[model samples]
Target: MNQIIIFDFDGTLADTLDAVVRITNRLSGEFGYLPTNPETLSQIQNLSSWQIIQQSGISLFKLPFLLKRVISELNQDLQLIHLFPTIPEIIQQLQKKNYTLYIITSNSKINVITILSRYNLVNSFKNVYSGISLFGKHKIINQLLNQENIEPQQVIYIGDETRDINAAKQAKIKSIAVSWGYNSAEILLQHHPDALIAHPSELIAVIEQIKNPIG
Candidate 1:
């Protein structure tokens, strides 16, 4: 069976921190949360998503509604979003190597497709699963594993957040945390993912190492 690589979209593939921070601040007033400033934004990178949520004072009960609104708002400016430098080539190289790639994200399917299409990456992935709950990625990951009849050891989840690492752990799969996203390298290291990659091209070596460990 072909090995599967599950990816988180927002920070892992797309450089969405600027867009997300802008959108969140714009919607903060109506959502009844404190807005983040440039300094606060830097601090947020040091914290996990859940920790940032707690600091923002946003009610947990209001997340689904807020998430829906954020997605709708972000979709309007799909042109403003972009993938990180070298990400497209990295993805293409991985696909060329016959790896089965999949993306699981909390963003809307429409938005993800729009961005992927913009970068000519729409067909690179075997599947793109979106609209995942903020804290429910583990469930989605587990479902994919069972649906594909793939073993946890045969899969690796690459993401840029602490929650992603935790979810991968819960699903019993290896986690590769990337630093060029919402979470800083220091914060990601604290989460203790199986591998920590700082550049897009490094992914190739990491995957190879996982598939064939030094013995």
Candidate 2:
């Protein structure tokens, strides 16, 4: 079966947490947002993006500009970003199996592409859809579905955040929550993703199970 697999870039594919924290702390003074401490980092990992924004003291009115600056700073430190262990192999194998891959992310496309290209994994995804909005990813998913003329059942979105699972549910599509990203496995499970993956290799099995269920 031809499956449309949508992935989230930041926590899902690229390990940007530490780097993001460093950048955020470096810019917190200038942006008027609170600098994240070690404890706050762990706590924020469990919170949704919106919750994190509120806790960080960033005004909603300034979020777009903040996002743009965040992206700009992140791009400068692209050397620190990398795909999680075994991710390149998993993605390559999925591509070899003829799965249609796409990435919908809040991170900038330039940053995503730079990392993918660095690791020679740029060709794995068929499309890279990016946005800065902390909400409304479901709308982006819907737009992708319409653009490709595909139904919800034919696609599965994989991410490491609560928002990702929520967006998938809102779009009425299956979601695979990855444990290796921002949100903890426990938190991700609470969102009731169709599948929860602890490692990259589990992705192959989940896709197979989704495509060919046995009685």
Candidate 3:
């Protein structure tokens, strides 16, 4: 069977920190709360928006209103969103190797599609699963495994958070932690993923190593 690679969209595939921080702090100011400092915000980059709100002690009642406003602003800024440097080349190389790729994200499907389209990467992925239920990645991975008849051993999951590592473990698939994304290297290292990649180009080598283990 062909090997499969699944990616986390926001922090792993796209460099969306600037837009996320800008909108988050803007909403914080509007709600009369002090904005999170860049250093602190950087640490939580892997967290979903709702997770951020919960961790920040924002009242649940106000969260819906604030999130709606922030998302509205983000939608308009999609065109300006930046892709991680070398990501396009990396994807191209992976595609050339006939690797089946997919995206699993907490983001809405519309947003994910839009971003992928903007980068001309819409056709690269075989499918996408997004806006899933809270803590949905493990479930999604299970479904993908069943539907595609893919063995856990033949799959690799790449993501930027501790939760992602946990989810991959729950699904019994190999996991790769990306240091260039949301969580710090220390935080991700605590999860002890199958591999940790600090650069986009490193992914190709990691996948190759996994597929062809040395004696």
By TM-score, the candidates rank as: 1, 2, 3
Q: Estimate the TM-score of every prediction.
A: 0.97, 0.94, 0.85
Give the best candidate by TM-score.
1
Which candidate ranks first by lDDT, i.e. highest? 1
Which 10 successive residues of model 3 have the least lDDT summed?
43-52
lDDT of 1 by residue, 181-212 (tens): 99999999998999999999899999999887
lDDT of 3 by residue, 96-132 (tens): 9999998887666677788888779889999888644
Where does model 3 exceed 4 Å of error? 29-34, 42-55, 59-73, 132-134
The whole-model C-alpha lDDT of candidate 2 against the native structure comes to 0.88
Q: Give the clashing pairs for model 2.
A: none
